[model samples]
Target chain A: MSDQVTPSPGKRRIGVYVCHCGGNISDYVDVDRVIDAVKDEADVVVARDAMFTCSDVTQEEIAKDIREQGLDGLVVASCSPKLHTTTFRGVARRGGLNPYQYTQANIREQCSWAHTDDREGATGKAISLVRAAVARTRLSEPLEPLVVETTGRAVVVGGGVAGMRAAIGLADMGLGVFLVEREAELGGWVGDLPKMFPNGTDGHELARRLQDEIHRRPAINVFTRAEVVEKTGTYGNYQVTVRAGGEQIRLDVGQVIVATGFASYEPEPGEFGYGAPGVVTLADFTRMLDEAGSPLVYHGRPVKTIAYIYCVGSRNETHPYCSRYCCSAAVHASLLVTAADPGVRQYHLYRDMRTYGRHELEYIESRRRGSVYMKFADDEPPLVTSDDGSLRVTVRDLLTGGDQLAIGPDLVVLVTGMVPRDNAELTTALKLPVGLDGFFNEIHPKLRPVETVVDGVSICGACQGPKTVAESVASGLAAAAQAAAVLKRGVAELDPQVTFVHPEACTGCGQCVGACPYSAISLVERGPAKVASIDAAACKGCGGCVPSCPEDAIDLAGYTDAQIRSMIDSLLVGSET
Target chain B: MTPVPAHAGTGRGPRAPHGGGPRVLVFSTNGISDPGIDLAGSSHMHYPTEVVVISLPCTSGVKPSWILHALERGFDGVFIAADGEECAYLQDCSERSAGIVERAQELMEAHGIDGRRLRMAAICSVCAEPFTRQVRAFAGSLAGLAEVAA
Candidate 1:
């Protein structure tokens, strides 16, 4: 294995340029002092500085140096690589050097910003960062980009609120979409819903309209009772095997979305008599509303008095999170009942009326409408009794000086919360990460709301977390916008900072392939030793495969460890001298 | 009515109000944090004289872009609010938000929009009060600016 692996040798004739950034760095740290310090660094044939290293004029200067001086390697000491690493790399490429030969030093946020009060300390840290980049660049090698042709289509999982909206939005953008729903019908959980609050729009109508629109659009392919069985390939080109209606079908697409909306909360056995006849959940209520048009006329008798129990299988010691949507749902349920039978007395029993957001406004409105709200402490929960023949709920009212109020009515509505699907088979197959609550985790809660850590994959709706119909639709649209934007460009842009595997150095023990969390690296040719090749689009620029390569034949394009560390060394040397 | 605070720097751009009049302050965070406030000129906000522009930063750390946009909207004043500073990496996000609000006020006075109309303030999640107050303040500032123009 050792004999099979050797580092890709670095080429000679290197050029180094330090950017003054128009005194952004020069004013704080002595740019000339740093430049003088690294002028003779090993393998560094020429060194120079400019007022604005990122300017077009400076790029011309670097280009001229590469052509005239025959410089093979390039290093730029300037702002953080995040800002302008691509600019210098482009300059290097324009100057007849492979873009991978260039490296950038981030002396701005990591150093200058931190050490503004202490010039000496800032200079020292800047030098260390630059030297590290220089050391790493010496070990850098040219890497090739793997290009794959896309089928120009996308697969969207789940036919719920999220999936349907994303599908409609994407189809509207002129992209072909295969929207797969796991159930017999589309519209995830929202399909069963009666009415959406605030606007009071019919839920079923929205789903039907969307379904009609999707059906009308030639680009959209809707499949019911479908599931993705196997998935492979990289971003902009994915091979997926889906099982739909007992038929196994394969598809090749450019992108995929998992909008698999969450399942309704199914209380474990004996946890609140969840499955009992009288103990109906929120979803059951939606069904009832759809079927009977009212919770009041249950079994054909007008419900004189009804008690709504909030937070079923939620917010207890077992489940820490307050299923965010329950309060609003409960409030909406109360309004729905009032609309059904105006005379039905609605009593809402709960621990806390956490009617957050616009729901608070609704809560206040509900109160004005004479809906009774009774709060019960967590330890002293309200009691539910169907054993006495009639549905009777007993609760001690905190507002009424400890007096217990017992209401016997025709029915009791249990406002159950949403919970993630229990079976981990599907999530495991995709290698997607789940949150503590088992919902799919987004890349960043704020920054990358619709995007997943895996490129070319986005998630929306309840699959991410509990949200209202409006929120779910908005999220679905956002996800669609992002995915559509990518396809609209007609071509995916590689990071240019990805790693490449040298086949000649192949001791490919398959270690690096396994080390990649993204599953971007794979064994391309399996023989005496498997040949490791990186799918460029799938590789996330995470240097996991670099250190794991036992033979050290693997190297990243832009910011290789050798390149970054050498730059760091150059900065430190400049600091000392 | 008192003017709202300006958060970023003050300025007037090419899109400033025709006849150099006061304009509405439109603060948008690219429909991410403050999706509730529709700058898209939907039926809810059809203020023809009102300017509408989207922003892409946290409701915190609003830049001079807010000030310039408000003046450009051609309303006598401006109002800006959005998501709170929960996960912002920009240090002093609220301060930046406030800085730009102040700068907007300065620009409004210089560009003839009543400075009172250019207001910036913190808006909590799902609460419409801050937004409502800013709208009322913008209207009042527009009235004040109209009186000056008249």
Candidate 2:
């Protein structure tokens, strides 16, 4: 009890302010009484109330008071820290105090509005919460952000449009880039396509153009027939080892961008009349269309009718998610067929046409150009049966009152979807997180779309999820911009609230090794005694490994054990409940 | 003379607001459940004033001694607002947090405290209703225990 929150009277000068919140709080709790309650406490040199503690004038006044009185600890009983921890930390900094010296007490959300019916109770609770914060401030040691130097190079996995574009983007920003492709050539899945949508550029031609640009850049090194075998070290100083041509080459880099592309889904034998003479996947059909002349001949048969099936292996119980780009690709393919020969009859069997955005015009154009789209329900899917090298497709038309329709055509094209490539080896080496859909998961789908939980690692292109050519390129450049922003500054700043390993208390038990999520903790010899050592740069300050140690040897810096215990004691003294 | 720590008023008078109610200390994850608890307040959802929340970076960081300390300091119960899969730190966050709760419960049993006094449930980022409802239910159970003791 002697070492608990008893701030020595004249040693620590603290300032406490309770906000009225413009009646948001004062309507329910007595803000002035809260000030009167704690003003006479030993360490409180200044106790005040503000109409809005977050206001500009009040902020200036708090800074002025801190400077005039030489106050060390500051507490503002106002809004949640999520909203204004930075705003008040600025005041602490301007007053010549460390930013971590400031503490926020959430009275509006946690007290006043929560217990509107009981004003007396809310005030008592507010006093407890604020005093608990003040006690924590009294014990908090000033901490500086951890800064580490960074290598000025990045590694891009895969040599698809996204990877090639990311490498070009990184090199353009004056950073060296290493582009690795699994295949013998520089192009990837996108490079093998017939003609990409939204533009009539040939796949091989586009790949050649990107390859030429990459070859011209002296900073960009292209490695074909390679794979990222191992990655070690923390962010900003990673050593990535790539295996190429029976040799392993290690590259020191600051960031790793995973642009590994998706795999084309292949239908099983006899499913949707596949393995028959005329039945082929959309990918196979497109390649055949590129080789054949007008009238669309396959197996030397020029006179023909074609039927297409949508969503071959996705959007069901097994996959349970829509492959986003198939509908537009199918519609664009139908337009290409019509351009070859307008007299050839074509029918598209589908469920939910999702040609979103401007691509909706392509669906409309395909329909206007003599291709018929028949909608089908989920339960009543189209069935394909072959009769002597010819195909018959039957479906219940959803748009036309569930009417059953049957059509015999010479060609049956199955519009297969994209599936995530099984990157089991790479996943283990980099600790990449995979979603339920089997695609690599981002931190946030919208805000931090390219960044992974692993620091300095970014996922781009179809490997993350299904994306069109344009979207893949967009994410590629975005990952490059993020990597550039991290490495170009030549330094990385991490939170100082990471865990601290007390050597005297540690017994080298190795309990915290398995507990650390970031693999930041390791057992090392300390004066012939084994002890846990933590890499502060790799730690995310989650304090996840603190409780796993049996000896209580490790603790978080900002929210230490002594500080937490003192906080609870301050709120519970004189009570035996 | 050293400054005396400001303590909560403990008048033995007629059940004061802070004196009678079962005081529960909550360990909430800063990234996930803290914002949800705050949303519960912003939505004007009501819970007992006896509920106090202390935000930690993650629930896995909770030590069993912290729970025992709260109980020994006269807290009626301890609630852990877990982060579940929403924890950006670890993929196995739920399992690690459950391990902590188990150890805390064992400590409670050793100290002659009922294991039922401590509770844990996953509260996500926007789960305002769940946050209020669970805390209210926990308060009722703690109050019933008090009645049984009396």
Candidate 3:
């Protein structure tokens, strides 16, 4: 109450205008009926209904009416304020009235649209909504927005293709970007591969292009072997701390993009002979292929037999998922190896030959070559062991219905899988929810893929979960697009669906304040009595404060229990249940 | 015959490399029956991937696995669009399949794969994704995997 923005106390003149929204609401909920019913209300000075109150021409009409009619407060009963609260607020400011003195009533989604056939009930609900707004507007204060400082620069985490893409996108937009990489180099796991799918260009080339572009950009600041240590503040202004090369550096940023990428499972050294001289993971194999520019050779001689074990880190009752790329990578690798040496006996010991797409054609052609395709059931996996000092694998052959066939192979290639990163730390740090698989969760699965439940934060790349390079790049662009939308606004208006404490009725009970999970409420001394005030920017409209209020003083805007009960009563008024 | 886990950490809880799981998930982009039927069967034995059977209509439906995090939290693993190009839903299965595959692999590398437990795949509508078999084999092989030292 030290600097309360209470409105000037006096006889308040209220204006109520209902919009047709070009029949979006008027058709179902009788707009004229709503205006007619509220016209006689004690404090209402003018009540009118318009075909489209949100339209530019109509908004201008509203501003003109306020000036000529000397209106003190305004109420617009139209679509959800989510769509036009700014529109009406802009009009109020232009008309020399404090924009905070306006109230919005949603009669579309909650009433008319919800109760389609019940016209009488719909109209009654509309009246209640209007009445609630009117009541709230009567207690409205002339509030001013708090100006939080902005940090001009931004931090882009994760140095993968998506991180690089976002960093470039942000830098090109004239914003300084700090690109951080967890690994030693800028190119992510993609750099270790042989080539990309479809277009089939060397993965190293794409990595180089991105690395060079980022390096050349003057606005881009690159940091490898770095991790985000701390982040605070709100959207458009954030203070981020990073730990890189054992040095802690703090930076003020306008935004942050979490492109922390994903990690594939690397089996323990002993399991599957992963680290043995003759054994290698698909990633390692790919790296070796890239290094040698050819198939694997043992002791400077062409290898006669090579055994590939599929589902090394994926698909089991325990792990229960397919590392989607392993099969394709194996197929691609097999094709490359076969093309390099036709006489090489390549046995693709798999539960299934998943050479999908053009690889299917390749699998078909490669099988005709010296490459062998075998299937093993989930219950019957291939066993790799040394028989008489010779590396041999025993697998149940699905085609021949046989078991324990030993093949003295020269090399064993294990195809591994992918999973989320150390997401628990990330989830706790950001107060974000993790999926069952322990990945960052998005707000809406389809509509808001990049957006989180928290405003101003977005997730991209494998940090969210499993995905391919192309998909990761696309999601990176999507997250950037979403973050840009919020940044473009420069300042976001706090949503009005928040709770307010009746200062006079409050008894200094800290229950409600403590109950607020969003940390929106606090008590301050107003003369003699301690009053609770809500920090609107931090409120998330969760209504958690209501139950903890012992004085019955806390009331929420847009959805007070009384207002909801009244609306519900009206909806069920003429129904037979 | 012993059940080949769909993912790692099937019988042994923490020993499986990286991935976490008790539930088995099957990542199928198309029908359960496909040209690579054996691969689909193996997919059912892995750790997290063995719990839920996610039949994606197309690779495009994989989204950014972050989108379905709620669903993932409820299960052990999430097996989605697999590797290969037999998708009847999306014509560009090659790119879409590759995208899903890459995403899953990255997750595994990050140690978020349930101790390297979760998985994803790429497959066509007619034949369940081939990555399913690979996932199962990977899980079965995790008996000797080292536990993450506390």
TM-score (C-alpha, index-matched) for candidate 3: 0.58
Q: After superposition, how far is residue A69 of candidate 1 from its true place, in Å?
A: 8.8
- Per-residue lDDT over B14-47 for candidate 2, one digit per residue giving the tens place of the 0 to 100 score: 2323536788899998777998999999999999
- Model 2 interface DockQ: 0.42
Sort order, TM-score high to low: 2, 1, 3
Instruction: Work out the TM-score per prediction.
Output: 0.65, 0.83, 0.58
lDDT of 2: 0.85
lDDT for position A179 in model 3:
88
CA lDDT, candidate 3, residue A234? 65
**Model 1, B9-88: lDDT tens per residue?**
22222222212323344454422334334321111222222222223334433434334443443234456664434312
lDDT to native, each model: 0.65, 0.85, 0.63
- Please give, for residues A1-577, the per-residue lDDT of candidate 3 as tens digits: 0111122334777788887777767777777777767765556777788888887887887888679778778999886554577889999999877787888776664445544555665676577567656665666666665544445566888888888888888777677888888789988877766676545677788888999999889999998988787776765677778888999888777667888777777888667666566678887777766766445576575577889999887777546766566777787777777777666788888876665566577667667776777788878788777645467777777877765566778888888767777755545455554554556767545656877645566788888876778878899888777666555556554555567877888998787776654457888888887888887666655454664566767766544545433332222121111
Query: Which runs in model 3 stand beyond 4 Å of their true positions?
Result: A1-151, A268-279, A293-295, A298-302, A307-309, A315-323, A347-412, A498-534, A542-557, A567-577, B1-150
Worst ten in a row by lDDT for model 2 chain A:
A1-10
Docking band of candidate 2: acceptable
The per-prediction CA RMSD against the true structure, in angstroms, equals 19.0, 5.7, 18.0
Mind sharing the TM-score for model 1?
0.65
Q: For every candidate, what share of the true interface contacts is present?
A: 0.00, 0.61, 0.00
